[model samples]
Target chain A: MGKLYVIGIGPGSIENMTLRAKEAIEKSDIIVGYTKYVDLIKTLAKGKEIFSTGMKGEEERCKEALRLSKDNIVSIISTGDAGIYGMAGLILELKDGEDVEVIPGITASSAAASVLGAPIMHDNCNISLSDLMTPYELIKKRIEMAAEGDFVISLYNPKSKGRPHYLRESLETIKKYRAGNTPVAVVKHALRDGQDVKLFNLDSFDDSQVDMMCIVIIGNSQSYIKQGEFITPRGYKL
Target chain B: MGKLYVIGIGPGSIENMTLRAKEAIEKSDIIVGYTKYVDLIKTLAKGKEIFSTGMKGEEERCKEALRLSKDNIVSIISTGDAGIYGMAGLILELKDGEDVEVIPGITASSAAASVLGAPIMHDNCNISLSDLMTPYELIKKRIEMAAEGDFVISLYNPKSKGRPHYLRESLETIKKYRAGNTPVAVVKHALRDGQDVKLFNLDSFDDSQVDMMCIVIIGNSQSYIKQGEFITPRGYKL
Candidate 1:
């Protein structure tokens, strides 16, 4: 049986792709991803079969990738770290095969954290507010727990147009347990097109500044914004 | 003023390095990092002046990297995602100028998390038990709270020759909150030389199986062992 490589391409940029990701992309006989991502890989992938789909069609794409991997080398690409909010969970759910190797990438939250500064340094937890398949009540409960535990929290899928008003509600939920002065940053389309990072306190945010692709990082009670940088000290220092 | 790129090279393997990391390393006139990490960039850094120092000498290294960036193109290399346990924090501490760019890399914990299955999916946090700078008391408190919150925890610097009993003590503390059957995986030199990923549970482990380079991930109450994979569901799918 041929092997399957589930790769994280790292936020849509060719530069952010690891050598292994590049090699996997180059060597794979078939590449499967969303149509937009397939277009992104067009230049690197020549004379190979390409399977593309639309948004929310990831399951279908993974199934195809698995079917192809039975006969030839196949790769499924996810933007940023493949495990965090990537195809990893879906693929694992399918339990396609034991030969599946999940190649991790720089997660969008990690990249955004790097760019936005260290609000997640100490005790941090990442939670997505998408509620697409997961219910909102569960997300709120998790957020409350993270806040109560004083965790520097990372929020993925914070906003969107059709799903627009979720961030405000999420912020309200966060504010219930966290102080209003808690540091919040909207890292929009990180490392991708239209990349913009904004540092602001949750209490002072302008709701007009975010969209779906943005990853919002909210610091714990201990998190502070220093000179446009959001930092949560890990409690260990020289 | 020349630009300073804080690039994350991901975990140990060169294949895990992003294309942007390679470009930054190539374009840099001066490469600053620990000697071991400087070695990681040696192949692509043919004409660059490499500035290296011993471990625990990071403050001086950061100052030198900053000083050189005033007149030259300089890049600081960190083994994992430069943000997570990387040199990006120290660089931000200096905050020399406004022209610094942070490029993210794959973090070791997440990479290990991927290899060990879903041990770090959600409702989790990462803590490093080096205690070189952090007090043991604080580490204990955080572990307790993490356990209380049911966090799937990733531990860095679990056991060194100098601190052979740290992991054992940690295991005791973790047992206070987590069940004996809680899954744990010690990934020694993950993706690096002599890499070995050992999977077990709290009830089955001893201190002899770990090292300083090993990253030990302890699962929460919800974590389980199946098919040789330590699984922690994010609860997103439900």
Candidate 2:
């Protein structure tokens, strides 16, 4: 007879978390998530019954959270917005979603955009390069279409050990529509410890700097670098 | 010189705002924003110098915030994530992009997604139908491309008194790629007072249910409603 809460903890720091996200973690009897995400919020989860799993154990983690929610107030945490490539869907699917509440948080793209100076000030699309659950071909098609439409593109899970070539291929697909001078940026661990943000051009950005922990932003046709910050105008007359 | 903080307040409630956003408001000597957005956080702005403008006064508002920041710490508030179709770009443009801090908050799309279950649990695109700053042709093209890419599409500023036909026209564009039975949702004032979440079929949803304040989500081809919540699977083996 207890409720389940799927919480989006934003980026790592306690300061970046919403009041409700913190409240959800405080009010819960147990916490669950990927090991790294749980470690990120271990400060808030102090003294709470914690459950965690490795990278590929999302299914087991969600199922465990759902089972526990049947009897106790359990929280399943996902970094960034829980609904965006996060664990909200899995929890809602596993449990008939009877008593689940989703607490929204700042997404990685927005966090990166803030650091890069509003690179996504216009219409935008978020595409993940992880080919685990989604096919590479479908993700590539989305990249091409977003470029063709001139949408500000945010790339998540850009590269990992398993998918080494997907990020480069996705960039090649984007190069067809965007100019060589279009601004690109890599924000590693945005709002978290050791956050690093660097800007590059569409044709010259070094891919070696990107990894699974980074969120890459490729500006649209109108995006540019001004005073060292990547910016995209919202159809403003400059 | 004082610094300018462009803060996103999330949907509307203080509980939804990040700790950084709250800290920014508390540290600001003056607060500047649209009249309604400023009203949403007036409790925090109490006894502080508050300057607000009506709609269509964004340019004037940005200039005023910059002018005041020369001698006072200013926090310019946006209701959602400030970088997306928000005031971040305008402020960055008006100033020389110096000594400004951006505090990201939960965007309206994420807020709406939370209320609508997990409708955007996959790759997605956010498009605004407002043509005041952007040309109608460009907005329409983005809609077509997002639909063609099979992305979960989120529409903001869907309808206004002046742009009454844009939402319907945009829906028609989406219908060409998405099936008529694809799940769609309209979330009005998400996370705020008078919040409403409604799910409908792509072909049957009423356009009158949407307005400038509502965020409409058109699910991808694979989306469906379950347990009365609009749910989109993340390629999980159901």
Candidate 3:
């Protein structure tokens, strides 16, 4: 039996990927991922068999990776960390006899947080606005609770072409518990090409600025913008 | 002025460090970090001037790094992601005339999540139990809200010899909202020497097993344990 490595390439930048993830990809005979994610690792995928599918084809991709891992060292890549909305869970569920190793990668939240300054220095929560797998009501409740708790919130898949109101709705829900002046940031394509970061207060936030490729960070009440940098202090007295 | 790189070395393992972080360290004239963090990157700091201080010396270390950056390229290292309870905020705050760049790293939550399956596949919250900086009441409130929101909870500094009851208190609070069967995993020294991973249910969890070095992940109600892996699915099927 061959080993199956589920790797997170880390925010679309080859420089952000860990040595372990890079080594796994380099050593794998076959690399499998979503087409976009496979394209991110094209340099490492050289001389290797590449298998990729389009969006919403995660199940097929995992099945294929598992099948290939039965006799070959296969690497299944996820854009961010493999364990977070990545292929680790599905592959683990479907792998019947193969040995699997999950190589962790830097997550999108951390990548975006790095770009946006220390907005996540304290307790923080991450919620996805995509209603594909989760109910809208549940996500709303989570947002409300997170706001009430004063946790810095990171919204993933906040806006897509099909779902335009989710980010707006999420912000509205947050506004009920958080002050209108709460600092927020939209990081598009963090650590990747065409990277753009914009800062806004809750009242001034424009949902149209976000899309599927962005990670939206909503700061806690204590979060502040300093010299154009979004920072949530680590409770240190300055 | 020379450049200052605030780098997250990533969960104690050199293999987990990003290429960017490694390169920044290699090119740095001096490396400054907490003593323990400095030890983690000793291999990369070979023959380089290293300035390390004991715990709670973050401010002094940041000041020293900033002072050194005025004349020499300096790398201030932090375990896990520099932005998450690491040195990025401190360095940024202390930097007056220097150019400081924060290089993101793999956080402990993501590292532990990979080891214990995909517990953070959806919304999650990270809370630290250490009361040195944050008030105990605020920590309790965040824990309560995170539990009420059903966010997968990752507890940093969950326990220490000095504060043994925090983990127990946190679990008791979480039990009010989540079921006793909710899966929890404690990962200590992830990806480094003497790494240990422990799986338990909420009811069966032992607080004595945890320490400051461990990251305790409590899954949401939707999470399940399959084949010894704790997986919180991405709600793909409902």
Q: Is the docking of candidate 2 incorrect, acceptable, medium or high quality?
A: high
Per-residue lDDT, model 3, residue B10, is 94
* Per-residue lDDT over A136-192 for candidate 1, one digit per residue giving the tens place of the 0 to 100 score: 776666666676656677787777676677778777877887888988888987777
**Candidate 2 lDDT, A152-179, residue by residue in tens:** 9999999998888888888888898988
- Measured against the true structure, the TM-scores of the candidates, in listed sequence, are 0.90, 0.98, 0.98
In the range A1-238, model 3's lDDT, one tens digit per residue, is 7889999999988899999999999999999999988888899999899999999999999998988998999999998899888888888777687889999998899999999888999888888888888888999899999988899999989898888988888889889988888999999999999999999999999987788999999998888888878888887787
The deviation in Å at residue B25 for candidate 2 is 0.1
Per-residue lDDT tens digits for candidate 3, residues B1-238, read 7999999999988899999999999999999998888888888999999999998988999899999999999999989999998888877666576888889999999989988878888789989999999889999999999999899999999988877888899999999999899999999998889989999999999877688889999999989899899998886651
Q: What's model 3's TM-score? A: 0.98
Q: What is the C-alpha RMSD of each candidate to the true structure, in Å?
A: 2.9, 1.1, 1.1
DockQ ranking, high to low = 2, 3, 1
Clash numbers, per candidate: 1, 0, 0
What DockQ number belongs to candidate 2?
A: 0.90
Return model 2's CA RMSD, one decimal. 1.1
